[model samples]
Target: MSEPVDPAPRGGGVALCLPLDDEQRLDASARRHGVRVVARCSGASELAARIPALRPDAVVAAAQPQYLDAALVAACDEHGAKLVVVAITRDEQRLAAELGVIDTLAEPFEWDAQLEPAPGGPAPAAAADEPVAATPARGEVIAVWGPAGAPGRTSIAVALAAELAGRGGVVGLADADTHAAAIAPSLGLLDEAPGFAAACRLAGHDALTRDEFERVAEWVPLSRGGMSVLTGIGSASRWPELTAERVTATITAARAWVSTLVLDTAASLEHDEEISSDLHAPRRNAAALAAVRAADRVILVGAADAIGLTRLVRARLELLEHVPPERVIVVVNKVRASAIGVNPEAQVRQSLARFAGIDDPVLIPWDPRGFDAALLAGRPLGEAVPRSAARAALGALVDERILESAATRPGRRGFFTRERRLA
Candidate 1:
């Protein structure tokens, strides 16, 4: 008889609470490295209760100010758990240190590298030579981005989320457009609720934990289709400390609870100097760029008309430098079939291919009636008009691409391996 195979020995388990959607992917990766993971409460009090019972070897709190608060750090230390904080900006780094967190990870991290132990930390043990379990990459992050001049970034983003939600798996839409605060009104989300602004506040405080985030995020249901919406900040001025670190944390936490994360970003790509100097320059909009870089895929929105197409071509060139070509998707919005001249799809494709060399752009048909009605009612397109052409197009994309691709990615790496620098 064949000998029985022994189970792989798992290293000490770690408890993770983060604000970013990518936390799920990261957690899966950590398990691949033979480490066990324990998901704690989304609130601080519950987390405090679970800590002693779980006796985690380490604690990873992403971009939540409360997690790094002096009291929490002291609690972790008292319990003999190492704490690692993932920050988005230099200020967060300083704040983390002040709170006694010595380890950190930045956003847009390479999955493998980010999971590695902090500098000077001991390396993780190797996994059993057995094949790693297949796990999906984090949910798809679709960005509806267009240049200034009403290219319909927000409209497309909202509609796309509605379509995806209609198809079922949990979905979340975030308004990360710092320049334009339209998500609340566009979706008719009540400003009285603690939405994106509250999350940002938690992120800035250095005392926020994953549990805290879950408490503050508001869930807007889609009556027509599928998914939920996490509203964005009401104004740019309110997010002075809205660093990339905080955004990553918030997304990570959201991912643990949701299946899809859709971000509506500002048109501009310029970064604020005061926010943090760590970001690379010439790519101005650090926050939006960070979102794009972290996303599994990006959907570029362009107007159907002539000038819109022109801006799309130009923006494509700029994006090429930051994201891979295969990952960048071009979308032409407000297309009209009857509006004379050459075929709208063919002409737009030909123009983009000729100028920007991009092929196969997704074209969303004109649906002014459906869109206007939904906007006025403060509901998703799926809820307002389930049969709209625009909604169908979005569904096709989500089913064929987003969900399928995420389901097939390689399983996460389990063993943590920190970088080894040679003298």
Candidate 2:
């Protein structure tokens, strides 16, 4: 196990923000360790406002049930504060990690025994000198695509956003599939305001701004408990103005306002030749490609069947030219154990490994019953069927892998980097 970090005197004092018992324990521990414990907040909101004023060297949040939310985590990021979360649940530890909580302590931890900084060291400087090089701020775009069949690209995109949002960060979900946009109906999103399409149009003319874009977003309520959604085009005819550059800028602006920006792209990456004949054909594939290039992580979804797998393999080869394999997360969807052949997971994995050389593809089992229920109830998998095996599998992927990856990747500038730059 890694050694416990010593309390660093990064100029600012330590602030203990936790519940009553944990706060008392931490206060005693800090006093014994020769580190000053400043203030303690009972609630996350209170702590959020107090953080900037107190400017604590480090904030120790006693990871109680109530304190585990995105708002608190986002507040920490906003203030560029170091956070240590003490978790009561293993699941909470996973969730905390997803939210970028640096140091986590399991429950029943002896505060006094572990609170001190190591003998040789103070903590690393609270803030870096060079403004810690931010990740490619909102410039990376990802367009999720699959063939016409039940390739489950939309499902993967929705789940991916839900996971990112659950990490206590802002996420934007854009439906860019003009031909057969299903994000709204799939998530039971009722607002048909064409906000994303409008944003795309405004961006085309360079009129998109952080404020304006937020005003345009429809704020589709989430079913799985956290984050909001932004729906897309009402019809394919509206695709004329949603060009690649405009879409890219719009998404960039959205990412500026949110931590994760998820685009539900068109199934076909090929240019619409019929529309190409027109002056305003709106090169769809180019727009999709631009989004793919901008995304920090790209999830490519494909059906488990033979034809769907074939299309995915082909798409994988094409995507490799643009994105690194590491950035591309492949999901084999609609796998059914009772289906025609061998176990769906093994078969799909074997096929991808054999042909596409893509190993360890994230397999989403076929859950038509659960999916239909969610669709009918207008909820995400977590809400409509929280206990469903499909939901459990999705949670494992989202809560475990995607969110964890987002947290550990240093240099990520947060969603509002562009706004910060402009300010």
Candidate 2 lDDT over residue span 344-397, tens digit each: 787888878988788888888888888788788766666677777777777777
Give one digit per residue, the lDDT tens place, for model 1 in 1-110.
11111132123456666654545665557545554556533433445555555555555665466444665565555565555556545345445534433234433333
- Candidate 1 — which residues are off by over 4 angstroms? 1-137, 192-194, 204-211, 223-226, 271-284, 337-340, 405-423
lDDT value, candidate 1, whole model: 0.60
Off by over 4 Å in 2: 1-38, 41-57, 60-142, 222-225, 272-281, 406-423
Candidate number of the best TM-score: 2
